[model samples]
Target: MTRASRFRSLALAAVCLVLFSVLGYAVTGDRAPLDSFDVEGRNLEDWADDSRAFIDVLRVVEHLFATVGMTVLTVVLVLGLLLRRQRWAALLALVVMVATSLSTSALKVWLGRDRPEWQGTDFSPLSSYSFPSGHASSTAAYACLLVTLLVLFVRRASLRRLGIVLVVAWWLLVCLDRVLLGRHYPTDVIAGSLLGIGIFALGLALVDPRPRSTAAHAEPLPEVYASERRVAVILNPIKVEDVGQFRSVVSAMARESGWSEPTWQYTTVEDPGTGMAEKAAVSGADLVIVCGGDGTVREVCAELAGTGIPVGIIPAGTGNLLARNLDVPLYLRSAIDVALNGQDRAIDLVRVGGDGIEDTHFMVMAGMGFDAAIMEGVNEDIKKKIGWVAYVVSGLRSLMFPAIKVEIQVDDGEPTTHRARTVVVGNVGFLQAGMPLLPDATLDDGILDVVIIHPRQFLSWITVAMRVLRKSPIVDETLDRRTGSRVRIKASTDTPRQLDGDSVGEGRELWMECIHGRLLVRVPR
Candidate 1:
């Protein structure tokens, strides 16, 4: 979700709530027709009203699913989502519940509409402003949010439709109970229900406005020559100490699988893996396996883009962003098995270019400013010792980096100017520590997701962190996002930059283009 769309959704919901609250106050006053209709409906249902058993059941139901009860239920559900790493859905659910409850309270006090007078229906009395029914709004919000989640996740069409119907029916029953028990007028419940629906729609726009990918299955792989195909491995020697042992396992596995002897290219500190990958590809390798960190993979991928040979990954780095996106196993043996037997899937690769550097390709992400600082400042020895924890230390030291003014242009659109602490463009969703900076990003989507941060003060990092954790689309001056196939950025000063975690020095400008499905990757069948 972009910043503009998020702002517009919230504004529209606020307008709808205000309009409904005003309409309820203007029409549902003393001696109003809605009050007469409520009394007449009670009169028509005299037998059901006099049934002590039905009344007791409804009273118990209302007490159990009331505002307090629903709050508890929402907390439990949100906590579960967080624990499961479903942060976006949890934030949406939490926002809807809190906004619905708070709005109901504020509107009730503002309108000050009174409850229906129960003469002889055995309806218990309660004293409170009742312009909009709190029970009706709370239940309606839960129902609407549930329907949204069901539509997004439930695959069976019949099940989705049935779940929505059941939820709506339950909400209507709650509203009816509110009116029948003389706790609220019909118009009050109607307005409250509308408010709930409005909030729900807003939440959807904030968190899930983009249409989900609808492919039922991954693309089928082409035929592989099991008998004659040649396998080539680009191995980073420093990444593994037992090089002879690793080669023995590879050779044994290759022999057992009916493939020829594996061709090997050892990577050097000066030439990570790109030159070796080129050599292997030119030597007629059928499949090229990369065994190292993100930088090595990026180098190999850049060298082999559009060559039609599938690249397999053995994740031996701190942040295996591309491997995680491809669902490749992290263990060495499992990764080798996947590389040999897995299916090939086409994925997008990003081409980046800027001042003072040759064009390069990155399969994961590119960033400027604060993100680059975090990468550049990492202690190499610490990274080798403790893996990804080195990044945390660097990130903490770089939080107070100064924001810079930049002009950003998306595709053919006019350039938009802003001050930002960092700018990131990604082809995949998750980050090193599993934070989904771009929740809706897909590997083969043929576009890039851009996020910009501009927190005004160090204290505001808390707010920014919360928004990221929630995956909230709402943005003020502190955060914004955009998506496009081509992005051009020019900063006021030469800022630090990085591509797929490799430092690229400071540059004043960057131009990136998404190369759609330009590379093939091996993924588990």
Candidate 2:
């Protein structure tokens, strides 16, 4: 995470804790507002305290899931991570668990407030400080950790959402149990939840630092290697820490392969890489190596499309969709090796125009509606912190984004209108999450694959998610699909749009056509 963003989250956490502390002081002084609410809540509970059955049930839930149950769940989660060979993740969980427990205890001791002495039938005897309910704090803490872990570790959308729902429900039930059992006031539970959240935000920075580690696989091999001689590399300086080191690596590899010292071009925020790529092709470069994210790669690929010069990719982005589809290694060393020694393969590129985007190209997919909303709404700070987990967070937030009515027309076919949450056009099947969004789509297929999702309800998304996960052949009205070389879509309104995860301004119409085997890219042997 960036220092400024980290500071903002930390400041928010600190503000919450300070607000809770002030409330604790005011409650001790029997001040207005908080004290008034607490006393009123106590009186209401006393007036409504008739059923021992519900209280007994709540007590049972508290006893089963509080201290011991929480500890057991933590152990099991950590053990599961360890079994999965995620030692870093397991260690992180352990640290956060211990930190949360100790911090909660310390806060409780510091506050040193007594439990409610109301006229209600209290199910359990509590002889400890109650300014912050330990049960509520611990439960919330567990929920935060487990959800974050799920967002980070779980790849399947269905399983991740299910796990999050179950975890959150378990904790919410625990909070209700504490409040209903008359062990804590509403203020105490609220404070506890805030404290848990604060600790979680803090732990994200302290326990596990930013820029988390990614697995490094062995260097990959390339197919037939032939160099007509000259090479040029378009580099994105912001994407790498030490640009000199990357350049040195490329130079050493290129020299080993009997190629001349490469012509280096740096991409700027204003001009990503297109102009440089064109210049390289015009200067008779046999190969153009792009060492940057998808945006840079897209620009270079689009610029050199029909020049017969192969483009080598060195992926440095979070969602390197094109590289992933091309079976290119992600590691810098391996990707450089492939760029220097790999064979060229012809692949299809989808050209998308209109809808505020003029004559742009997407080697992966073009999406509108819900998918575009996700790309447009993803939090920049969170994305820097947790990588793809940021997408999950954005996606969850955008699930309720209104659907759009779109008329899709394939080549020489009649237009069909549907209320769709998203309409995606793809040249490749697998998504960045490895979900086969268009199972039958292939880069060299010489056609475009389309999928339209129209979930009847929010829960119906599970059915769509399952279908994608299983690569089901079930194509019905809600999950309709079509394919053609040319596709024209007109939305009912000017909707958000994206070409390979990059947002194109809102537009009502999108015209796209596929160019088969139009570009050459390097891939693993």
Candidate 3:
């Protein structure tokens, strides 16, 4: 461990010591448990009867596993980080596990209070300690550790806020469980929680912080906008029925942000996200804000590939998956706000083709199965009737759609064949809410996520729907995953294609390859 790690560990240990010491001496006067000393406590039998359930559950877990749940949770987090190659994540997990264990063990042991024995229950084993619950300690410690890791690594500010909410919720649930299970008094659990948090924070203070990758430098001089910085707002006017309306909004937003009038581009179904982005580059726009839906973003992103012109999103089309995934504000105002002030995040884009032959780039995903078919079939008439829920009604309409034959060649992986409805390729997870459609999908690491869904029945459609809605990995006995820096997809027939949300006309045989990460995005800090 480095100096930071050592100090962090010691800090946690020190906080634990101080809190335990104060609680040991000031509160409850360090009383021993009734069972340990054979001391008679008022209402001892009642307390014993109430805590029976909690002890039983703990005993069950102990019987099945030698150690408590802390180690298992630690393993889970460690394995996740390990698989993801997130070294910092592993260290943070270790810190949380240690902090939780130490606080739980030391706090109660030092209290020297006797366990409550209401009935003929065996309080014989642990009678002396009572004030603090090991369960509460473990719960608080585990949850706090998890939250700490999220806070340290997760990029989106709103998501970090959500993680904070989730951690607090976990704490509440754990506290309630302990009280209802009669394991500890509400006050005891509360104290244990405080100790857990302190210990974790102390632990955190020790680990060396990763050098800020995009730390803000000196504040900029007060100016409406960087006059030197040129901007081009590329848009897919064809996305909405009225490009005129979307244009008015984009033009106004650009001027308000003190940016030069942007050169507008409308992508046609014939030539979606391609060429147009390159057009932005040629124009020398310092910043490129894409105002259409996911398809337009993908196109703009494709062209912005290699060029460091920071891209922004003004999501207008259906299924703003990338925008949702990036946590770009849904409302135009919030989107514009972030477009103007948000931290710029660099995300990977998959260029699915070799040097010239019919190549495509995607920011959300790329697949060739039922999902692809849905994207191809979705029409504006249906989309206008319903926003994203169109997937449900449209999906039902697409049940009769036949599967197409395709050959997939993953990097260094064997070619696999699948007869499916549509192959949906993804760069980010949420196909709809932009929730993480792929839990494993990270915007930074340069790799494409290929989801192969083999839904055999109507029930299968439900399963896919659930997968998209949940924004989690949908793995089953039948689901296959192919991950690589590049992928080549060849279809026997001209299958329907869509990038982002807009349809990318049909193609008979096409190849898809990943660009190995290279997209500049304008985001908030």
lDDT tens digits by residue: candidate 2, 321-424: 88888877665666777776777789988888985667888888888899999999988777655567788998999997788899999999999989999999
**TM-score of each predicted structure versus truth:** 0.58, 0.60, 0.51
Candidate 1 local lDDT, 167-261, one digit each (tens): 89988898877766667666777788888877876886777522322121335345654436799999987776478988987777667655589
Model 1 clash count equals 0
Error of 3 at 94 (Å): 41
Q: Give the TM-score of candidate 3.
A: 0.51
* Model 2 lDDT, residue 306, Cα: 86
**RMSD to truth, every model:** 18.2, 11.1, 11.5
Off by over 4 Å in 3: 1-227, 237-279, 354-357, 403-406, 434-436, 463-477, 490-495, 505-510
For candidate 3, give the lDDT: 0.63
Q: In lDDT terms, which candidate is top?
A: 1
List pairs with backbone clashes in candidate 2.
none
By lDDT, is 1 or 2 better? 1
